[model samples]
Target: MTTALIADDEAHLAQYLKQQLAACWPELEIVSVARNGIEAAEQISAWQPELAFLDIQMPGLNGLEVAQGIEGATRVVFVTAYDDYAVEAFDAAALDYLLKPLKTERLLACVARLKAALGRPPAVDESRLAETLQRLLAPPVQGLARLRFIRAASGDMTHQVAVDEVLFFHADDKYTVVRTAQGEHLIRTTITDLAAQLDPEQFWQVHRSTLINLAHLVGTRRDEMSRLFVRIKGHAQELPVSRAYVHLFKAM
Candidate 1:
């Protein structure tokens, strides 16, 4: 019943890994497959799959960066064509590393280790893994503090919106819209930049251009096609939830 995810830019390799995994560990359930690191990260955050097989080099973000940002219990396994990253993969606290043109024997051994690890109680939570991996892989940067307030502008006035009071942040054309219970204001910051300053648990990236405050999330809706959408407090319109983030609401 162990859920897993496979991430690789090479479609053929990803399929090959899936085939090998079926033979090596038939009991393992693959919850999703991602073609890029960004999709991998979003899926991991949403599904919290127990195991993630990741290729180091991918668009949007690298495998190391994706692994460093997961806020869940999912463990990572590096699958790349290069052996040079073996040392750094270990430094990133990857459960195991698999080289390209994967060998049956090696994969079986990895399966054995994964089974052992899963049989035992987790020694560390997902947050610790992320922090450790980030320390090892990411460069030090300033402005690490979370935002407390945002300057939202309207025509001639700039309103200071408390971070907690905001409902959601939406990117519209060139500006990002800041919504609150009272009204909406404009800000020029991108969703990526705003997300970095906000706590991941409080705000969620529901769409590529939208970061919504979980505190204001009232409900979710599904249409005839089973497509999902979210309803926020005081907002009449239901915001669409991208497929990458749909797993986050699985329990809801």
Candidate 2:
């Protein structure tokens, strides 16, 4: 039996896709379902599924990084909502993909191709995929205006801080902290919301509740146990990087 794995941060979306896949390809066995990139990467490495359905913007490593790290024969079918990603590039690379708001018709076509491809040798070119990811990351997603400033409240005083000055954004109970070299301010905005508004190239989500400005990054540190932590310029404290996002700093 052909085995597969589905990886998406959204639980409901992953379950829905599983249901749809059961209907579309009843014979295929879905060995695992992962809710984050780290989980997905580990599962893929352990199971070595014949196919992997990867969501492009997953938490932890993100889909591109996860796909890049795969060393097995698992063929990938990208599941993404970002229409800005070049469809022609995916096609040219012989990579199958399903767009968000997935249609049964499109999925059926993708399933057919995958089924046929499995009968032959894996033809995916990892180098091509890497190049594609490079291009995709270079261009900013259109239609979303990058946040230039934040208005936050600190005790009795409200302050306006330029987005560039922000060292990091950390979740603190009911509010999020807007930290800069000068000081910190509390904001009602959630970390997830801030991530969406911030420039993709500048701000990187290091944890579920933390987003750091790469420009202000001092360096990374590892403890005795080899756990990773990130240091910010002008900030005395180090921020913990989640296990899932540790791959982001491996190059450092």
Task: Please tell me which predicted candidate would have the highest lDDT against the true structure.
Answer: 1
Give a tens-digit lDDT track for model 2, residues 138-194: 443457677999998667887889999999999876789898988888888977678
What is every candidate's alpha-carbon RMSD to the true fold? 7.4, 8.2
Where does candidate 2 stray beyond 4 Å?
86-89, 92-94, 138-252
lDDT of 2 at 35: 94
Clashing pairs in model 2, backbone N/Cα/C closer than 3 A: none
Score residue 136 of candidate 2 by CA lDDT: 54
The parts of candidate 1 lying over 4 Å away from their true place are 125-128, 141-252
| Winner by TM-score | 1
Candidate 1 — which pairs collide?
Answer: none
